[model samples]
Target: MLTNAVPTTNGPVVGVEQGAVRAFKGVPFAIARRFAKPVAPAAWTEPRHCTDYGAYAPQPGHLDLAIEESCLSLNVWAPAADHPLPVLFFIHGGAFVTGGGADYDGSFLAAHGPAVIVTINYRLGPLGFLQLHRHGFGEANNLAMSDALAGLDWVRANIANFGGDPDAITLSGQSAGASMVIALATLPQARGKFIRALALSAPGRNIMSADHADDVARRVLEELDLAGDAGAITSVPLPTLFAAVERVSRRLADETEAGTLFGPVLDGTVIPHEPREVFADGSLCDIPLWLGSCRDEMAMFLKSMPPAAMIRTTERQVRAAFGEAGWERLLSCYRATARVDEDPYEALLSDAFWHRPMSDLARVHATAGGAVWLSRFDHRPALEPFLSQGPTHGADNACLWAHLPNFIDRPILKRMGGPMTPEDIDVAARFQANVLRFVTAGVPDIAEAWPRFEPAKEPLAIFSQPFHVIPLNDGARFRAWAELTARPGAVA
Candidate 1:
């Protein structure tokens, strides 16, 4: 809903929040769309309307379902500030498969802290981070990383006229986006570009190896009866190429190069290291951290599962993935969270698969002396009924942006709001403010006493309609799980 434009040295700007300031769009910085590569855009004279978003690159098919590739684009929401505003650059996460920047309207987030909020589109799936045994055709990997890096370069070079503080930029992302942050954090060069980062709801272990990339390339070659070189891969249609990758994925086991679709490859180039591996080294030694997960992250994926069905699925999967001790540790967590002795399968999955990874990551942050603020995003009544998606992995974005129901109840949300409780709206506002604050000042304190990660006392600050600080770690439990994982048996 842009009303008018304001011209400047960089470009013409369109008003993002009618009552606030404006932002210009598509001001290119990097020369090529690929890695540290490509031709630069020619200089323009006329100020263009920054109202519209740029084209989103083709995205991979959704594993939960399939969607179109039309949602790629970047959006900025900047408000007038008495001083240069802090900038928040958000990287949208979609499992390296499906997602779009349009899903996040920066206005909701930017307005809260009076910051410049940016949401951008990046390449996805095989086009983003797939590797091959040998170079063939236009074969490449790490397109995802390239997209993010390019976007950052763009922000650094041009966000000035948009009222953004270049020196006060904070890179914020969730899930795959967070993974990108971890990768960038370890990059020797990407340092000094971003002042800080806030990685929300990112799973700790992702990324492939050089051999893994070669294996995937071999699989694609076998599927097409081609050679193991990159030169010939360009001949295949985009759909055919992606489908070939898919065939290997659905049929293979974990880390199996025999198959995989739309996931990042550890090609040892753009992504020099795995997230888990470099995280322990404290590469980004002093970057402030705010890490967390939802109370029912699995409930989102298991939206179709009732409590009982969730129990069955958790038992089956955990038993298969972790084995006996895994099962027991999960059982103990369930017993503690749900006093009725009923198996909270979703909760079990939440702690082991989601919560624990974040906790483990926090320990690394603490060791590095980085200020770490950890939390458990709690939805008082669970997040199943909204958006037909439960408190699924990426669901917390709703609260962070105050979209959907919360937006409806608030006057500022415009058409995005509906009917949400006041509590919902307030909590969302706090979360939004925290995101902006983190982006602007590298701190997420809602009010008095925004505490630090103190595993010795309260290990986490649980965020929800009624938020609180909680002590969730138990030495014995962690040790037991560690033993279970180390046994070479199972960890369910």
Candidate 2:
């Protein structure tokens, strides 16, 4: 049965109950005005009915959700348990552009895990990531990062009231959200807030240098015809602001690698040092990490590209980044390892952008004496479009949240191929069980079979029909990618 009211730091909130799960949706975690830091919401005595989701952060109009500036809210799903449970704090991925806490329904994970699940909404696009500190917008740099921090603060202070162990929070995220997890793990302010981290399909690089962010900010301002009038930014209508963001992003796409126009900035104040540097130096070795990428991450993005053009473009880029000899060696390795009918270009792009960087991070984290588990989602669903793509980007989400019926038809899963089969459900159950183990015990239950990542053996769990852990055997392929990623201006 649903609780009459759950006390929070700011006030009491009423939630909906379904079977053994209690879900509190659109609970305000923080309040913020445009271009300002988030602050605690006003306290209230009357219980707030957070039965419906709050408006999404002002973003490019796409998802048919209400957009507003006061979007710093979070959702929670907890089992009907008396004792406090471990909390899984998940961040949604939308390439720092689209997505919201409501996009993911945590009821399934919460019920099955018997753990509290928290999903959050943070600012997005120009409204969130535009770094304008150098342009006299002091409170604007890394606003989304700040929003995440604010949410964490709220959780740490009040999650226990909702039947969660505040001290045992596991920070988990995917894609752009995964990058945020990496950033938070490295941030000194975020220490002690979460016990462990899980990152899936984190981009090779999402942090933008302050100078680069400044350039993007200036371009955005120029597009809006408010170049020198930084004060006018706060008053610009959402549509006008987003239109300028789109224009600036299009112009910068060709100028920058991967068209990454906006993301967290190394403002020297919020994020003092680079995340890779922190990971390499062993500073973050104490926290346990579970991270991985899909087998073919780029297939989703390259699906629309004509086969002939895809091959030509991939060849031109590969040859330019890596010499002809390097290209041949890489191609040979991929031809041997890639799935049947998988495009060489798609495989190469996936490796260069997602797989290689994840592997490198795993090796360094493990080398530094950190407890880490690495895995790859290789299970291709027995469905149409996804069968052609073969475990493409965001496919794991389909398995991870398969228990949530409402979630099954969401874009991340539906577009990847939904209406899961019996085989697919079996795989999902196994994946969720392992994830729950990690969230509760700080280590996956498959530890006996899947040993901690070691640089020498490079042990990695392959999540497929017959899930198994195997030491990485493709040194040649990774070596080729390492060289390409090391090249200047390479997106990897």
Candidate 3:
């Protein structure tokens, strides 16, 4: 019996049914050309078999894997074609360079609920985000985001066939994917694609101006030694072009300390304005928002720094960036909150980069009379014995999705392998429930009510071993950093 057969807006797709859930994989929503805007896929009359995941965007390390230009596809998981369910539209994150929607499994989430989940794959790295249209490339600015828009359009047009309510869509993502959600929330083009958004660990500061984007593109050309011939950037061998992207990215990171080498740029057409400015002005669509960061968002990166350098150079750099007065306040705050001497640097960075920026965004949104609930994911991983610290960047992902990321190395898993403790199990269940509830009902379904964020009450959902809510714990030092960032030329 071909029970999984479903009709999409453009074609008939045959998926696989297992128990209550049916999944369709590698369904092309758009056809993409290298460094160009994605176009609608050609319609098909025959049933297209969508049983396996499709090829993902090209990245640096996966050279041996078969990469392709037509990689704009989406995977869907639903209960049945007859029931209308809430839709969770998810975007995957890999620092804006790598990652496929397949890395995150939505079957568990969809099977346990009255909801349908869709995960999309967009262009990454130079192929996706590099703004090369100035040199005759076609709409190269924010190509990754453009691909996301196209996928959202497809969902709006065809999710009904997958048992999803097109009007009750929740856009959700983490890390770089969270950044895209924030971008869509601010951009005029994405006003009604999703009714609400759940942005986890949104790096609201990644969006750069058009001039900076063009500068990066120019440096990429220079790195490839094609400075005089900009058009050659598109014609170079794929491997060589990827190598040049790596070199240019590493150079940018070394010199400027940027998190992502290529991402959503403030091109006048695609992204109208700097994202921070847009969020601050309360220009985002009036959608309920659930967003926050990990308690130790920077510790994952800090683990790689030499212990001595982290102790000595990190604070010194902080002082150099801020002033003497600012440094003193930051030190006081760090000392007040630090668990150990080595923790001060990590705390400073965590607040400055992730926590503070998001807090500011919440403040602006709440002031604009939007419904917002903020939280901090404090649950540490039960795995990974090599690290001495608790829940760092990407740590909450395992708990949030109830599955480990595809990139988790087998050796690391083996050495630190352990069953989820009772505490871990409880937290994961509650966290997943709250997320599903928020997507379905516009509020969390935890044991206690998740309060709306206000300046005085400052409610937050702290997801620890026994998940609970609390008043804002970030102290005056965090507020100082937020104020400093609001000033021009301070941080972005």
Candidate 4:
């Protein structure tokens, strides 16, 4: 069945109804040019049929979605309910380069959560993260972040029409999107927009310094042969512009500390200070958080590398960031914890990039009087090809969205661990329940079994076959990483 026309700030929209869930896709939230701030879309009187997804931001071809600048749209899935329901607004992750909200299907979560689910699309790659205002291109620093804010603003004003409580919204994301959630928490403009946050597999570092971002912009200009005339960027062909982005990314990967050219810039105005610092000082402690990463976050990347090469590359990087002595101590600590079939280097990269940073942030946030919950997805699915890699990156998403009809057919999940098993269903039910609990109740679990994260105890919910909560053993390995992070040039 199809849903009746629903009124929005911009206009009325008609959507599709699947069972008890009504899906409104391709709802334009805002509109923007190549390098300008997003503004609300023009008002329309006639009801628009939004049965299909809108175009996604331009990027290197990965998904088969249409690409265009007018990609600032969102999708909504509202379940049948008599009263208002909490909303889960999610941002998709692709390293700030590739991906769109349409990649995720919110039907399962909407019907099961009995909550309104909103997924959004934002600018990407050079179109999103390239800092060009300094070079007189336009007011383009953190434009994608601005786009996210605009989406939230639209939701705050229009969600109630669809039976969602405007006051209770949970901002959530995964990977690069998770980093944006953390960044949004520190922005004064985004302070009261969202009530809680859920960050999954957020990188240790995603913000780029102003100087580095400027350098990247310069390199991109040079690649496009527009270094002398930066204003010409507005007219460059899309394919040519993305090609330049790829070249600049490859050239600067080894030079930049964060190992990527595009990300949210530490612009003095938009993002005043480091997010971790803000969380450490208790300035944003009022908002609760639920954050975690998978056990083998780096396994997906390192699966193809020979063990010897993987160890050698990891050793060099670790030694450069941390001194030889620091590397030796870390090696000893990880060796003590490594499984018989596990590669210590893989574990080291995973912890350095994802696990340790999340753990540190949780500790600091808890120390600063914030209500927080820490978790780690440790269930390794029974699928093969890379089964020995254990619970790898994107595994959490696989379990979280397993109820979607096409979960087994999604290419990424298929590559990770797919063909959904009975065990996967069991894990997905548990994972989705915890998330829904937080969205509706503000706390994940009230029972003593899932106590709030505290710095003194460092408790973590381990999401495995038989889920359990235990105090994390922050032993020698953690200390070694902490010491390294304290050093001036350490990326973590």
lDDT per residue (tens digit) for residues 31-76 in model 2: 8888888889899999999988788876666434545656889999
For residues 1-492, what per-residue lDDT tens digits would candidate 1 score against the true structure? 664665443455554444544644444333333212322354556655556555445544333232223323466677877788888888877666656565666665666678888888776666566664255424366666666776777677767767788888888788778767767666655777788878777753445566766676576678866764455555566677668776776554344422334455566666667665665677765788778777667665565433423334344566777766567766776566573522366666676657777787777777766777887766542233544443556556667766535442321112244455676666776777677677777777853456777446445776675767766655555565666767764433
Worst 10 residues of 2 by lDDT: 305-314
RMSD of each: 5.2, 3.2, 3.7, 3.0
The numbered model that scores best in TM-score is 4
Indicate which candidate wins on lDDT: 4
Distance (Å) between predicted and true CA of 70, model 1? 11
Better of 3 and 4 by TM-score: 4
TM-score of each: 0.81, 0.92, 0.89, 0.92
On lDDT, who's better, 2 or 4?
4
lDDT of 4 by residue, 1-492 (tens): 679999999999999996789999989999988899999889998999988878877777733454465689999999989999999999888778877777777888989988999999999888888999889965889898999999999999999998899999999999889999999888889878888999999876757798888998999999998988999999888888888888777656555544567777899878888888889899878889999799888887776543313234445667887777777778787888788977787788888777877988898899999999999998886555326668887778767766632243343222432466666677767888899999999888776879888877778898887889877756666677777778888854
Query: Global lDDT of each model?
Result: 0.62, 0.81, 0.76, 0.82
lDDT of 4: 0.82
Inter-residue clash pairs, candidate 4: none
Give per-residue CA lDDT, model 3, range 112-216, as digits (tens): 666899999998888888888886775788999999999999999999888899999999988899999888777788777788888888764658677767878
lDDT value for candidate 3? 0.76
